[model samples]
Target: MEKQTPPEQDTIFDEAELLGDGYDKHVRRARNTIFVVASVQFVFGLVLGFSGPEESKWISIGIMSIVAGIFAGLGFWASKKPYQAILIALILFCGLILLDVIFDPASIFKGIILKIFIIVYLIMGVNNARQTLRIKQALGKE
Candidate 1:
């Protein structure tokens, strides 16, 4: 009688299948993109804050700059904790959108198209960050 070879067991979480080197590259690109975007936001806020015509406007711009700086910092911190950073970014984005709607309801209709584009962009960024976190976890690097 010929000896029979045993079949290999199939594992649910195969490291090779679950984690690809491409994910690492993707995560790096996403992190850099987010950081650049946040930095630009902070810089623009700073310019607006400083170049305002009136003291009241300056104060508002200053507050906006501070918030933008915070988001930029969060983007940098995403390298270490992507999920937390993405959550904070999303929360900040939502808050800003709410404030915009509350303060300028009339302008909202005029800029509805622009606002929609921004909303979509923010959603994609959040998704990218979330995917980075998942990839890290799956790769056992988290």
Candidate 2:
């Protein structure tokens, strides 16, 4: 009798748990995105910090830097912990915008810088929101 060929080897992709770690890929992706984005922003902030603020814009830069520092800190935390990272990022984004409004400055240049932060903040917001939704969904909470 001809011996039957051994059964075809199962590939790793054929496994039931290819998803890996049961962790939400979307959340992981979003966290990684923020980590990269925030790291870039942190570097950018340093560059901007060196440029002398406009005569009347020192206060504005100080305020914006404070806000940015907070965001960077939160982004750092999120980079380390995806679950809480999204929430903190969201809070940091909103807080930056609020600070921008609360401390309006006269210099257009400073305002534009604040606006850049707003834009970056928005990007972070979107990523964080997505991560938050993914985490919640994965947990079957909502």
Find the candidate with the highest TM-score and give its number.
1
Give candidate 2 misplaced runs (Cα > 4 Å): 1-23, 54-81, 105-142
Per-model TM against the reference:
0.61, 0.42
The TM-score measured for candidate 2 stands at 0.42
- In model 2, the clashing pairs are 78-85
Give the per-residue lDDT digits (tens) of candidate 2, residues 1-142.
9989967643533232433433444545445545554655565555665575666355545655565566566656654555566666655655655665677644335556655654564455456555555655655543
Q: Write the per-residue lDDT of candidate 1 for residues 1-142, one digit (tens) a residue.
A: 9999967544555655664565545445545555655665677677766777666677767776777678778768877876677567667766776877798877467557655655565566566657766765666656
Off-target runs (Cα >4 Å) in candidate 1 are 1-17, 21-33, 43-47, 50-53, 109-118, 128-141
State each candidate's clash count.
0, 1
Model 1: number of backbone collisions: 0
